[model samples]
Target: MSAPQHPTETASTAEATSGAVLSPVPDDVDTAPTELPDADPDSADAVVEPVDATGGADGAGGTDALLVTEGDVAGDYLERLLDILDVDGDIDLDVEGDRASVAIVGAELQDLVGSDGSVLEALQELTRLAVAQSTGVRSRLMLDISGFRAKRRADLTSLAGEAARRVAASGQPERLAAMNPFERKVVHDVVAGITGVHSESDGEEPNRRVVVLPDR
Candidate 1:
């Protein structure tokens, strides 16, 4: 078992939340620097602080229009910002469960994804905030750039399977590399499906990772 550490401590002392590890506290050793310029949150992303947009609100249902509204807000914000950035991409919006989802579609938009999709993750947060500001409520909007998230999901699922196999064969724990919250969740889900192995989170944000344990 790894030693537990405070949330503010280094990655070595990291602890897990939700029984699994990983994601952006916006810092950690696993994080890769991106090529995109540091964004100005106060600029186009937050420029529209209007409320009264429809769709999602507090306690929205799965099929609620609120999520769509949230997507619209985020999509509009992203579209305008992309135009300013001179990035040629089409923003697609969808109401995915209780959250709004947005994807920047276009081959030329790879630079927006950055190294290890760090730029995309940061952009996602900004989009969610933009939706919240426009709707006068919090938003749980997911963002994807150039199908990077889709590809990452497939890879993480495979990683979880490999980790499970290793744990089952060794009858020991296997700690995975640091990942983001979304990535960790996918890995945990995969771990839950297999027998004789269980998963737990370790470390802090940005450096937190999943640890697979064999059935003792």
Candidate 2:
């Protein structure tokens, strides 16, 4: 039997059917440093400390620049994907904290988001891999489609506050339904802001849930 086709696949391009993989890296883009200078035994300064390739001596500036590059790479990759799929959408990129954030906003993007944002999650992983392939460093880039994550974040924040209140009032632990990593992180952040209560994740992936506990 033939392999299943992605929901976003079209007759125009059979090669781009695999939404999990990005285009191969170009031969001209060197992924590694060419060489290092030889150390001289006669000089005391010959022994040099290893430098961080991703983020240099100025940690903040280097890290910010890397994140910007990640956003740009991700944007370009996503743009090509949209073109292949013949899907119309606008890509917006930004650097949020230590990670890069990208969002695709336009009509008829529900298919890309999939049910419960499953497809969106897969696309995000693919985009991160593409950025890593170009920069030779793993990326923690976040992707959102049609404001799904933004709205979800708001909803989760509210739910977390409610759960925290309930736990605080009854002095009992409350466990929420299973949530993905992104959802769990939002809940954890909200719960952290409220006093007298804390949150902990339990169970395995796809079944993991957050438990709100009152501080003793």
Candidate 3:
């Protein structure tokens, strides 16, 4: 048997039923890999860094220019993606609070959002990495394609609110099914906004789930 291929390194380059992955390295991005902070040797949790939410206009407590730069980088990267895929689209860039947001609008771009938004998720991470590389700062900029994510967010918000209400009435913690990190964040944030409920993520990735718990 041949050696196994690590998904993280090769998945981005593989061609599946949908579109082939665009170049992971955007042309404008520097060739050098980012030198991220060293992991804490003593803690397994060190792999995760707390999101800087205290700065900038988004409450990140840093310069707004970083967000703007991130937006610019994402916009340029998205334009190239459209060109590479032979699709025509216009990218809109904006800074919502402290995070940059990029949206693609066009009729022919629907395929970019594969079944269940798998492609969109990958593209979002790649875009974030591109921005991070360009600015030498981590970014949480949200990318939206054809309003799929916007609609999904609205749906998830409603679901989380309903779950929160039920949990409050039944006094039972509702464990949501497995979700991606981004989806869990949406559920957690939505539930956290309501009274008498809190959200926590459990399990490992790809199968990790969110549990909406009653406030103690």
lDDT of 2 by residue, 103-204 (tens): 887899999988777898889889988988888776777888888787777667667788788777877676677666666666777887788877766557
Q: What TM-score goes with each of the models? A: 0.70, 0.75, 0.70
lDDT of each: 0.61, 0.66, 0.61
Off by over 4 Å in 1: 1-63
* Candidate 2 Cα RMSD after full superposition onto the native fold (Å): 17.2
Evaluated against the true structure, the overall lDDT of model 2 is 0.66
Write candidate 3's Cα lDDT for 1-216 as tens digits.
Answer: 111111110111112112311122224432221112221222221232333444344335455666667777888888888888888877777776446677776687667877677888789889988977776666777777777666666666767788778877876666666656556566667876788867665557666656666666
Best TM-score among the predictions, by candidate number: 2
Off by over 4 Å in 3: 1-62
Off by over 4 Å in 2: 1-51
TM-score of 2: 0.75
Candidate RMSDs in Å, in order, are: 13.5, 17.2, 15.0
Task: State which candidate has the highest lDDT.
Answer: 2
